[model samples]
Target: MLSEKTVKDLIDNALEERSDLFLIDLKVNPDNKISVVIDGDNGVTVEDCMFMSRGIENNLDREEVDFSLDVASSGATSPLINTRQYKKNIGRTLAVKAKPDLKFEGELTDVDEAGVTLEWKTKEPKPVGKGKITVNKQAKIMYDDILEAKVIIKF
Candidate 1:
């Protein structure tokens, strides 16, 4: 079986040459099938995926170990898995699900290793007025509180 570390080293080497790229997920099956998902600070293109695939292929020896590799961008629909991804998505809308069935949609404002802060609008009663008004509020969500989070596409 092909080791994940060997494949990761190759991918890391290739990524080192590209400053914007980062690894999202790497999976190696018992049958020697490797799936590598990557993302970028700006965004990843099809050409980038092709380039990474070719680079990995060039480094590995097919005769020594038979393996199939699939390199792809962590597409728009994939859930956000890391802080880098959240930082990249700053200013974009995200649908976040938290514990105890809590869910909301908001614009990602900031991100760090600890968590992310989101800005959203909600209806609240004004202190001087009897009627409710729309107010912008921010929420800080820790990584542990997030059950799932994905970018919301606006058409």
Candidate 2:
């Protein structure tokens, strides 16, 4: 059996080489098998998994050890919008899904480790007729208040 230090060193070196392409999350199961979840810049394709698996296998083989390994992308429903996530998406808009299927379109003004600060657009202006004036309003929404959020790409 390969020691934990040996395995960690192998994984760290292998992953650090491709730091720009992917992020690795390593875990050890109760049975001592290793499970690695990889977060790629884009979605993880089969080729990526094969390449990573082969690399890890070759490294372990060199060290002469028997250990189980799994390589996979995040496969998360949504990217973790932690402080890091927010910082990465700075100056970009987002589509926020709130409770009860309510959605809000807003621009991300600030973000922290705990949550994001969203400034929802005020109400649309009404026609300047002989009737009512437009009511422009803005609201601040916390990250906890958001159910789902994704970057809104603009063409």
Candidate 3:
């Protein structure tokens, strides 16, 4: 059987050559089907995926492992798992689900080592008035508190 560690090492070496890319997921089934998912700071392209696939394929010996490999980029709507992903998406809108059933939909304004800040405007009742008012709101969500986060693609 093909070892996962060996495959991981191969991928790590490949990523070293492409500093902008990062690994999102890797799976090796019992039947030796390896699936590699990758993402990039500036987003992933088909050529990037091909490069990664070749890096792995060129290193492995087909006669010895008899394995199949599939390399793909993380989809645009996929959940953001890495902090770098958040940084690249700074100006885009995101839908975030946090702890305690908290949910937020807003533009990602900032990202730091600790968390991200989302900003949006909403209509709310005025503090001492009879009518509603447009209020700007922001939320800071730490990485630990994030249950899921996805980019909101606008058409």
Candidate 4:
């Protein structure tokens, strides 16, 4: 059986060569099928995935233990799983699904160790008038409360 630690070490070595890259997830199924998902501070490229794949394939002895490796980047629409991901996405609009059946769609204005701040405008009825007015609204959501968050891409 191929060891997960061995695979992880190879991935770490590859990341050492590229400090901007970070590991998002790693899975080693019972069949020795290894899946590695990575992300970068700036972004991931096709070359980055190839580099990571070679890093693992070149180091392993496939003859001794036949194994398969799949290296891929976190998809553009994938949910944000790391704090660094949130930091990189600052200023972008995010559709956040939070706890207690709450959802928010706003520009990610800030990111801290604990959570993020979203700012957006909504139409609200005026205090002394019949017509509605635009009002600026913002919320600070804790990381624990966030069920999922994805960058809302706009054409």
Top-down lDDT ranking: 4, 3, 1, 2
Write down the TM-score of every candidate.
0.92, 0.53, 0.97, 0.96
Give lDDT tens digits, candidate 3, residues 6-52.
89999999999999999999999999999999999988999999999
Q: Which has the higher lDDT value, candidate number 2 or candidate number 3?
A: 3
Q: What is the C-alpha local distance difference test score of each model?
A: 0.92, 0.64, 0.95, 0.95
lDDT comparing candidate 4 with the true structure: 0.95
Provide the clash count, candidate 1. Answer: 0
Cα error of candidate 2 at position 122, Å: 5.2
10 residues in a row with least lDDT, candidate 2: 129-138
lDDT of 2: 0.64
Candidate 3 residue spans exceeding 4 A from truth: none
Candidate 1 differs from the real structure by a C-alpha RMSD in angstroms, to one decimal, of 1.6
Pairs of residues at least 3 apart in sequence or in different chains that clash in candidate 1: none
TM-score winner, 1 or 4? 4
Task: Return the number of clashes found in candidate 4.
Answer: 0
Task: Single out the weakest 10-residue window by summed lDDT for candidate 3.
Answer: 1-10
Q: Which stretches of candidate 4 lie over 4 Å from their true place?
A: none
lDDT of 1 by residue, 1-155 (tens): 88999999999999889979999999999999999999999899999999889878898899998999999999999999978899889999999998878887999999988888889999998789599999998889989999999999999
